[model samples]
Target: MRISDIPVPDTTAARGALALATEYQTPALTAHALRSWLWAEAFALVDGVTGVDRELLYVSAVLHDIGTVTEFDNHSLSYEHAGGHVGIALTAGAGWARERRHRVLDVIVRHNWPSVDPSMDAEGHLLETATALDISGSRPGDLPEVFVREVLAAHPRGALAAEFGACVVDQASRKPDTAARRLVDGGVVAKLAANPLELL
Candidate 1:
């Protein structure tokens, strides 16, 4: 689903988030493309998530990387952490319900994978997997093979997830860091840019 389809408390909030994300400059075109792609994925996934709080996931995913857009350096975990507080304010401003807001906040706060609760799997699992797929890159070797196979390929959610993951990596690879890091702008953008078809 598109952001327009979602009932935001304030239409401007979504626009504002886009404005905020675009306010930075990265050395990579793929970085910018990745960010744009992930935002689209978040919207798509929100519409597709079942038995889950769509509003909460949507907001959390959309605002998951507000901080990283400015000075991303492959250090997305910190951005995920920093996004916690900002996500709350944005979600509330966007007019998500109170309980839903809290749920979104919880997802943002714990979205960091491997460092947080590896065992406490929840809806955030989808978020984590989606994010990872993007970071892993398009070439398959660029990203975790398991992510592409399990979350992006095997699962129904993987259709969007995998496509977005491969797209971001291929785009981001257009500009490789000095060390061949192939830095994607931020975690959020990197994930959204994962569409392999774009490369094909």
Candidate 2:
């Protein structure tokens, strides 16, 4: 489904989460986050994945990279780790039960991984795949061209490539043991080079 067609939940907590993400994240990251959620939702609709908690998915998508913001990057934690913590904290105030809150945390933490088995959690799996498609341009055929065009038209990529690359490189430099560093050492550059997307 197109993002315009899918209604984002109108809960007060959802609004607060979006505002917080907008306040902290860079413009590129904000756009990426929204696009990630849209891509995930689109894939889910095509695949007939059901029972997704739309609010949690939206919040998780928006806050997935929150740790990249300087205010949240005070420690040596990987951006994913920090982002997961932030997600938990943000949802805790929303009065979610412990189990539901942790599910959101799982989505944020697992999104950085190379793959997410759908059996684990449909939302996380969708978010992970969507992130990969957005960043590495993997599985371009999985999404319709019209949907892709609509998404990009709504949220232009602009400097997302350079901005995201620099963020990951900087994280790798700061914390060699981080996933960012591992990805870099494991040939992320080569992967990006092979990506068909015109990231520039």
Candidate 3:
């Protein structure tokens, strides 16, 4: 079940996405973004999914957690919303058309949703599923051990759980009405603590 390779798109948007992630995100968070994209690629390979825009998915994955970064954390906006806007700006600067740029925003925002219908947005579905696998260990057995190992070897989870846990906790404390609060209340910390990827 392991994919032999996890492709990284070589395009203006993809390059800008990684650069922005590296500049704004901690090394751990940047790795999480990279891992998220790797996971998305794995899913696409295994599931034989087609018609996804690779550049858009890659950019969205790189920027999905951007709101957790300090420079972008000053707003009262929920992290997903803030991250989505950052995605919008990045896509715009990459010369993406407005329609495709909005897809970047949509994908980033929906990645945090509990479920995303693939028929509605294939990239969003892949990202939501990928981030869920990375963050909370959802669908734990769906990804093969070999694939997971390859991704970890490339990215090394590092302190992603601790750093992201703290960031979400802080967001929850400040924005009680947001999904961060819901996730904290729903035991995301414990899930992070128990994530098999961390143990892997």
Candidate 4:
């Protein structure tokens, strides 16, 4: 669906998170983040998943890559961990309860995990799947053509594969023990080569 047609949570904290995320991320990364949320929402609807806090999901998605930004990047921590910490700091100002704040953090940190069982945590699972779809073009056929078209039309993946790959490669270069390093060492090049958008 078009970004304007997608359902974003209408909350002050959610709005604030979006604004902050936009300010922190590059245009391509910001589009990736926004598309990630839309893909997650689409999957959730298709799977009949319920009880998901869309606001929490939105916040988590937007902030998921904050650690990659220069200001939030931590030399000592994985980007996921750094992003989670940054998310917590940002949400704390929104006056979220401690438990709710932690929940958002959990979603951010786990979104980059190699795998997640959707039955275990809906938000985390969806985010993981959505990110994979966006970055690797892993399962685009699972989503409807119209929906995919609208999302890409709104948030065009202008060199996203190259840009995102460079981001991950840069992270790997700087942090030897990071998941990004593992991904690169674990055939991420082939995966990116297989990305459907590469042909475009």
Against the true structure, what is every candidate's RMSD?
10.1, 1.9, 1.5, 1.8
Best model number under lDDT: 3
Model 4 residue 8 CA deviation (Å) reads 1.1
lDDT of 2 by residue, 1-200 (tens): 46579788898657867898889887878888998999899988887888888998998998888888899984688998888788788788888788988887799888888788887788898899888887888788888887888888887776777788888888899988888997777766566555555542
TM-score per candidate, chains pooled: 0.46, 0.92, 0.95, 0.92
State each model's CA lDDT, in order. Answer: 0.45, 0.82, 0.87, 0.83
Tell me, by TM-score, which candidate is best: 3
Q: By descending TM-score, how would the candidates be arranged? A: 3, 4, 2, 1
**lDDT tens readout by residue for model 4, 1-200:** 44566678888778888897888888888988988999999888777777888888999998888888899899889888898887777778888888888888789878888877877788998899888888777787888888888888778777666777788899999998888898788766667667775453
Q: Tell me the tens digit of each residue's lDDT in model 1 across 78-111.
A: 4445555566666678786777566655676555
lDDT of 3 by residue, 1-200 (tens): 44345567888888988988999899999999989988887788777778999888899999999988888874688898888898888778889899999998799889988889888999999999999988998876777787788789979999988999998999999988888998899888888888988888
User: How many residue pairs clash per model?
Assistant: 17, 0, 0, 0
Task: Give the per-residue Cα lDDT of candidate 1 at 191.
Answer: 44
